[model samples]
Target chain A: LDAEAMAAARERHLTLTKPPGSLGRVEEVGARLAGICGECPPPVPESPAVLVCAGDHGVLARGVSPWPSEVTAAMVANFLSGGAAVNALARTVGGRVSVLDVGVAGDLPDHPLLRSAKVRRGTNDLSRGAAMSREEAARAVLAGAHLAEELVESGGADLLATGDMGIGNTTAAAALISSFTGRPARETTGRGTGIDDATLALKTRVVEEALELHAPDPKDPLGTLAALGGLEHAALSGVVLAGAALGVPVVLDGVVSNSAALVARALAPDAVGYLFAGHRSAEPGASVALEALGLDPLLDLGMRLGEGTGALLAVPVVGGAARVLSEMATFSDAGIEG
Target chain B: LDAEAMAAARERHLTLTKPPGSLGRVEEVGARLAGICGECPPPVPESPAVLVCAGDHGVLARGVSPWPSEVTAAMVANFLSGGAAVNALARTVGGRVSVLDVGVAGDLPDHPLLRSAKVRRGTNDLSRGAAMSREEAARAVLAGAHLAEELVESGGADLLATGDMGIGNTTAAAALISSFTGRPARETTGRGTGIDDATLALKTRVVEEALELHAPDPKDPLGTLAALGGLEHAALSGVVLAGAALGVPVVLDGVVSNSAALVARALAPDAVGYLFAGHRSAEPGASVALEALGLDPLLDLGMRLGEGTGALLAVPVVGGAARVLSEMATFSDAGIEG
Candidate 1:
C-alpha cells in the first residue's frame, strides 16, 4: 500500500462537500483503493471479473450435504449458461463471470467463459485420511494464480473476485478454518445447505476427527490445504495471492473465499491489505475466518451463497466509493466554507 | 403483504440450486418483493429513481452546523448539475436523480431535473417556537407525494427513493426522532456535518429543549413535523406515503429519510411495509428511527451523506433480489435434485 497516497485520500475525504467522516466505510474503502493504486483517486474498475472455481468434495459420501457430487459440475454449466444466482447478481453489478474447473469429479464441456485446469479428480474423503497430496495442493494454488493472471492480463480485468462451488466444500472449509484459527470444530462448523441436526453433528464430528488426524500447521498453509482443504480452496487462496501480487483489489465471496483468504494471508502476510471481504456469510466458519484475518466485510446481508454472488453485490459499492471521491466536488473546490 | 405470494416465493427459494436459506437476506428481500407486488418473482425495477428534497433550516441560526445556510441551495445546484455525491451514486445504481426545492432559502434557476416546490423560505428555530405552520407542514408532505407520483407516473420510475438536503437538518431530524420514538435527545442527537463536542452538546440541548417546548405527538405526524421537523423531512415523509400508496418500494436515504419514515409510518402504519432502509446512517437518530420502524438497513457503510447517496447504493441490491428470484433456474429444472 502507498502510504503517501492513502494520506492524500484521507485528506481529500475530509475536504469533500459532505460532513467530515460522514461517508463512513465508503471513505475508508476509497482511501484503501488509493492505497492500492498509489494515487489520491483510484481508477474505477470498468472490467470487474469474478472467477468462480467449481470442484467436488469426496467428503460428500459422508452425507455432509444432501446434493450429489455431480451437482458441482452441473452448477458450473448453469454458470456458463448464465442461469445461477451468481450470474444474475454479476449481471446486476456489471461484473464479468468466468468458471474455472479446478477439481471436479465429472468431466465438463468447454465454453467461452470456462477454464479447465484440474489439479486432481477431487480430494479423497478427508474424514478418513489426507484430502490431497501437498504437491497437488501447490499445483491447485498455481492454477488459481495463473488463471487470475490470465483474467487480469488478457481479459483486462482491473478488479478480481473469488467465487466457489462444491457440495461438501463447506465441511472442508470448516476443518481448514478450525485448523488455521485454532478454533474448535464445533465453533467453526455450520449447517451447510440446511442440514438436519443429526447431519450437522456428523459433519462436526467428521471435521473434528479430520483435524485431529491431519494436525496441519497454519504456518504451513500448503500442508494444511493438502490435509483438509478442497482442491478449489487451494485455488481460491491462489487467487487472493494473485490479486495482491498484481496490485488489484480482490473481492471475497463467502466462507470458501474467506477461508481461502486465511491461507493467502498465511502464505503472504501482506496480501491481507489487497483483500476486501464482500459480505459476512451466515456460515459460522466464514466469520471466524474473517476475524482471523482482521478484515471487516463490506456487506452483511446473511448471504452464504459462494458463487461470488455476495462479492458481486459489493463491486458496485467498491466502485462507487472511488467514483464518489473522484467525482464529488470538495468543500473548498465548491467554494463552501467548512 | 401478500401471504400467498410470499409463501410461493419462499417455496421457490428452496427449489433453487443453492442451499436452502443460504442466500439469507437476499431470499428475504425477494420474498418481501413478492409480498409487495402480490406475485412471485416481482417485477425488477428497471427504472429506479431517487427523489431528493432540499430545504433550509431555521435551526442553523443557533450554530447547529458550521456551514453557511447558502450551502443548502449550493448543494442543490451541485445536485442539479450532476456534480454531487448523490448524482454519481444514482448513476452507479442506474437510478435517476431529481431535486425538489421544498424549502431552500435562496432562489435557483430552472433545470431539466429540478422541480420547484418551495413551501416556505425556511423553518423557524424549533427551540424558540414551531418550525413551520401546520399548513406549511401539510404542503411539504403534499410536495413530496406529488413529486413521487409524477416520477412514477410520467418518469417511468418503478422504484422510489427518498433523499434530503438542508443545512442544520440533523438537529431537526434528531428532534423528530426523539419526539416520535420517545428516545432522549442524547440518544438521538449526533454531530451533523462534523460538529465538535461543544456543538454536539449544543445540538443536543437544542433538541431537548425543543421537544420539551413543543411536546409533539407521534400519533399526529403532521403536527409533529410542524413543530420539530425540517420542510425536507415532511416532504420525505410524503414520499414514503406516496410510494406505499402506489405500491412502489421506497428506498430511504440516511438520517433525514429515516426520521421522515417515522413520520410516514405514524401517518400510515401500512407504509412501513413498502419501506426499504437503504443503509444505516452514521447519525445516531437514523438507527433509532429505523429501530422504531422495525427496519433492518441493507447496508451499514457508516454513510450519512443525505443527497440520497446511501439509498442509491442499495437500489441495485433491491433490484437484484427480484432479479435472482426471477432469473435463477430451479434445481429440478437444472437436473440437480436437492
Candidate 2:
C-alpha cells in the first residue's frame, strides 16, 4: 500500500483512554499497521514465520572470514539442530523458523525444517569468477520467492521476516552494494567479525577487486546481483520481493539483508516501502547501505553479529504496533476530560 | 533473578542449526524472559493493561509548560473521546487503557474507562509549599497500588504498563532527579515541549526553587516523594510497587516513570528488576535517571513527549520475547546444525 493508504488507516487508530497524540512511535506503528492491512484494527499475524536462508560464500575461500568455510556447513547443521540464536529469537516471537539450504558446500542432514533448494554446491569464488551463473542465481531467487508465497498462502504466517546465515556474506554484500549503489568499496567494507585492521584492509582489497571484475550495471539489478551476490543474499532479495508483492512487512536484519534490499529496491522501488530496518549494526557498511535506502534503523545497540539478531529485536515493536491498533481504549470508552 | 539464572535460561534457549551464540540479543531476550518467569518457556501475558494516569502538576502553576494545565484535562477528554494517539496505539497492542484521575484539577466528565481517585483535587504548588503532604502522597500511592491489583486480580491483565498525563511532569521529574542524584539544576532541566530559551531558563529557576524549598531527604524516599512528587509520580511509584508484588512486568516510560521507579526501587529493590525501560527521552535528566537506575532503554529516538509513549513502544518486544520462548523451533525440532 502507498503512504496515503497507511495514513488513512492510521487516521482510524482506536481512541485509548489517554489523550490523542500521546503515545508517539507506538501510535505511529499502530497507524502504519492499519494502513498496511487496510483495516481500522489490523490482524496481528498470530502465526508468524521467520525464514532463514543459509548458504556458503565463495568469498570466504579468499580468506575473508576468520572462521573456516567449514563453519558454514557446521552452522547450517546447528540451525538444523536448533542451536542457533535466530532459532531462539524466532521461538521468542512465537514464530516457526525454517532453514532453506539454497547453497551449501556440504550435504545437510534431513531435518523437518530444513528445505533443500541447493542451487549449486556453493557459489564460485568471485575473485576467480561470478558467484553464480545467471541461471543459478535465478533459481536461488525463485526458491526464496516460492517459499515466502507458500508460507503466506498456507495461512501459516501473517508476516515473513527474511534472515541469512553465511560466514562471508557481508563481503559478498559489500561487493554487491558497491556495484548496485555505485559507491566505492571503502565505504561498503567493514570489520565483519572483529577482524584485525590488516585483515580488514585485505578484505576491502578483495571487495574492490571483485567489484572491478564484476563491473555490475545498476540498471540490470538482478544480473548484477547474480554475478556478485551470495545464494543467501539473492534468496533474501527474492523474499523481500515476494513480501512486497504479497503486501506483507519484511524486516531486514543487518547489512547482509540490507544489501539484498538495495538490489530489490533497484528492481522494484515499491518494495522498499514495505521494508523496515530492524537496527543499525556496528558494521560501517550497514549505516551507508541503510542511509542509501533512506531507511531508519529501529534500534542501535552496537550489535553487528548478525543472524537476524537485529530483526528479532524489532519483532516486538512491529507486533506491538499491530497490537495497539487491535486493542486499547478509545476516547469515548475512557470518559476523562481528554 | 541473578545473572546465573538468566544464563541458565539462556542455555535452555531452543537450539537451532547454528552454533551457540549465533542469534545473540534475540537469544538474550528470550533467555531473560525465561529467567523472569523462572521457566524454560515463559507464559506470555495475554491480557496486557496500559494505565495512563492523568493529573495536574503543581509545578504547572509556575509556568513550567507552555500548554496550560487545562490541556491536561483537555487531552484527557480527547483520550476519552478517542482522538488521542495513545488510544490508537493501545488498540494495536491489544491492551486496555485506563485513565486514572489521580489529581486533575478540572471537573472530568464521566466515562467508562475513566476512574476517579483524586487526591485532594490536586497538589499544592511546590514553589509555595510542599507539592503534597505525606498523607496525601501515601493515598495516591495506595490508589495506584489498588488499581494494579484490580487490573490483575479481576480485570485479567497479564502485563502492566505505567503511563501518565500531566502538564509540567518533566519539571517535577527534573527536580526529583536533581534532589536524588545531587545534580545541578542546569544538568537536569530540559525544554518540556518546544519551549524557547527564555521559558526554559524560567522553568529551570522554578525547578531549582522547588528543589531548594523541598530539600527532600534521600533517606526517606517516600517523604522526599511526598514533598516534591506530582500526584502521578506518586501514583506510578505505587504501580511499580504493585506490579512487583504481583510478579508482573512494569514497562516504564520517560523521566516521569523513571523518577517514580527510583522512588519505588528505593522502597523495594525487587521492583527495579521488574521494570523495562521502554525508551529514553530527550529530557536532559532522563539519561541521568536511567543511568542511575542502570536501565538499558529499548528505543531511543530523541522522544520526550511522554504519555507512556516509550513503554507503549516496548510492549510488543516484551510480548515477542515471551512468544519466542513459547513457539520457536528448538535444535532438536528444526533439524538444522546448531
Best by DockQ: 1
Positional deviation of residue B324's Cα in model 1 after best superposition, in angstroms: 0.9
Q: Report the C-alpha lDDT of model 1 over B154-254, residue by residue, as the tens digit.
A: 95699998899899899999999999899999999998778889999999999999999999888888899999999999999999999999888898999
lDDT of predicted model 2: 0.77
Please give the C-alpha DockQ score of model 2: 0.25
Determine the C-alpha RMSD for candidate 2 after optimal superposition of all C-alphas: 4.6
TM-score attained by model 1:
0.98
* Structural similarity of chain A in candidate 1, as TM-score: 0.98
lDDT of 1 by residue, A45-137 (tens): 888999998788889888888778888989998898888998999888888998889899999998999999998888899988889999999
Docking outcome class, model 2: acceptable
Question: Judged by TM-score, which candidate is best?
Answer: 1
Off by over 4 Å in 1: none
- Model 2, B1-338: lDDT tens digits are 44665666566653533334434454565566666666667777687787888788767777777777877887777777655656655654667888888999899999988889999666778776888888888888888888989998895687888888888888888888887888978888888765779889998898888878878787788888877888998899999999888777788888888888888888888777778887887788888888988888878856665777667767766776676566555655644334
User: Interface RMSD, all models, one decimal each?
Assistant: 1.0, 5.4
